[model samples]
Target: MGLTLQFIPYLEIEGLSSIGRIRKLLNAVKENKIVLLEGRLRKEEETELIKTTMEEINSEFKGIELAVIYPESQNMAFFRKAKQHFINMLLGDRQGLTIVGPASVVKEIKKDPNKIQLFTTDVKVKAKRPSKKKKNKG
Candidate 1:
């Protein structure tokens, strides 16, 4: 039996300049291995970008799933509200596992039995700072 999984893409849009990144994201979705997409859409273009991505993915992966993390514009909340309806739209009442974070997402995709994968040109940066050197006091 094929395992059902949720593929969430965690993207960071600095400003109104993520159009190229969005296109690359949609292109990745077209590969048909992704079950769901979960990411923060912080710009006005995000909705449209997601719509277009869904359409493209559907064309290839028929019945492709999409779960988005759309935070309220005014409140600046951090994933507090769960849109259960969106999960229903994709998994059809089934509780799917969420592949969060950049590394986890890549690991999940690589482990899928279907073996569908998406490639991107963008690079992910680690948020942690390098360890400081300890001074030797003689």
Candidate 2:
């Protein structure tokens, strides 16, 4: 089966921010059998919201997987500490994954890529492992 991914953009304080988006996203994940979350949480409140949401989801769907993406340039100490708490709260008994990249990269992806697409004929490709061949002996 293909990997199921749920995208949650960074939280903003304005109306209909990422936190609300996350609640809907999580519900969709539960319904669609999503196994991964590719998104960002910019604020401490966002993190707390995630923890609470995960707990709520877990009560119904135990061992649900979550994959989060964050910026690498963030304060490592703070991220590390928060990550520990996040894991213990949301992922302690469940299998999950996390990825880190530059903030710019995440921002770029979070933006509307259609505005920058060079070609309309671009085709998306799926990742695959290279095949190995046997060597011949002389």
Candidate 3:
């Protein structure tokens, strides 16, 4: 079966605080669910997220893997840049995504100038059993 994913901050909610979003994201991570965050977190928030995740991690539970992606700017207007900078400052983090989850399923997070890659692995195929000979009774 495939995993069920949920996106946060993708839609504009009337009343949603940064802390609220953080809580929702954290809860989903705790349940081992994949969460797609729209934007990046502030520096303080990033630190907090790491701290919290580290605390929950242990022998059985692997630590969370974070992949921060700074998307290419499409509209480089002065106004747009100013607005983005203001928002980033307010949140105390850069513009990107914060992914958190168990490392058993998530690994080899790669990033390029074009895009980000996650979950790279080698697949092993099992060999089939040989058919038995019809050495019937006499």
Candidate 4:
């Protein structure tokens, strides 16, 4: 099986409803495509996405692993933090990256303040050999 990575820009999902966004992300993940979204989803939307994924979990569709990476604000100065918050509010979009991938394919996702590491599992497929037939002439 081949792996596919799908990139979704903020504008593509900016105007979508909460459910619409979740559906889009979930659909991509279900198809074994890792989705790299430009911006992060709201807390409520994230919760809803998990809920929907849980409901759809089955044998083929194991689930999903989601991660969000953003600049660390804990060590930032008060003024700088304020400015970041202001910018996010003004743009109505969080300055971050969101990754969503199927649990079957994505083994793990590790993140720190500076970078993200995604680990994937290799899927093994068996190829069938064609049968050989022998013809007899009398």
By summed lDDT, the worst window of 10 consecutive residues in model 4 runs over: 87-96
**Number of the top-ranking candidate, with lDDT as the measure:** 4
Cα RMSD to the true fold for all candidates: 16.1, 15.6, 4.2, 4.5
What is the C-alpha lDDT profile of model 3 across 1-138, one tens digit per residue? 355456666343214566665666777766766666776665676777778777877776676667777766666788887887787666544356656555655666777877877783344558798989989899
Residue pairs with colliding backbones in model 3 are 42-92, 42-93, 43-92, 43-93
lDDT of each: 0.41, 0.41, 0.65, 0.89
TM-score of each: 0.31, 0.34, 0.67, 0.82
TM-score of 1: 0.31
- Candidate 2 Cα deviation (angstroms), residue 95: 24
Candidate 4 residue pairs in clash (backbone atoms < 3 Å): none
lDDT of 4 at 108: 94
lDDT rank order:
4, 3, 2, 1
lDDT of 2 by residue, 37-132 (tens): 333344564465558555764444532333344344344698786776686466331222232221211222232312221111223578787877
Q: Better model by TM-score, 2 or 3? A: 3
Summing lDDT over every window of 10 consecutive residues in candidate 2, give the lowest-scoring window: 113-122
Report the lDDT of model 1 for residue 35: 38
Who is ahead in lDDT, 1 or 4? Answer: 4
Clashes per model (N, Cα, C within 3 A): 1, 0, 4, 0
**Per-residue alpha-carbon lDDT of model 1 for 1-138, expressed as tens digits?**
222333544332222255764654454544423435444443454566646555544323432233333333345344432455455455432332322222213332333443434332244666798889899899
| Order of quality (TM-score) | 4, 3, 2, 1
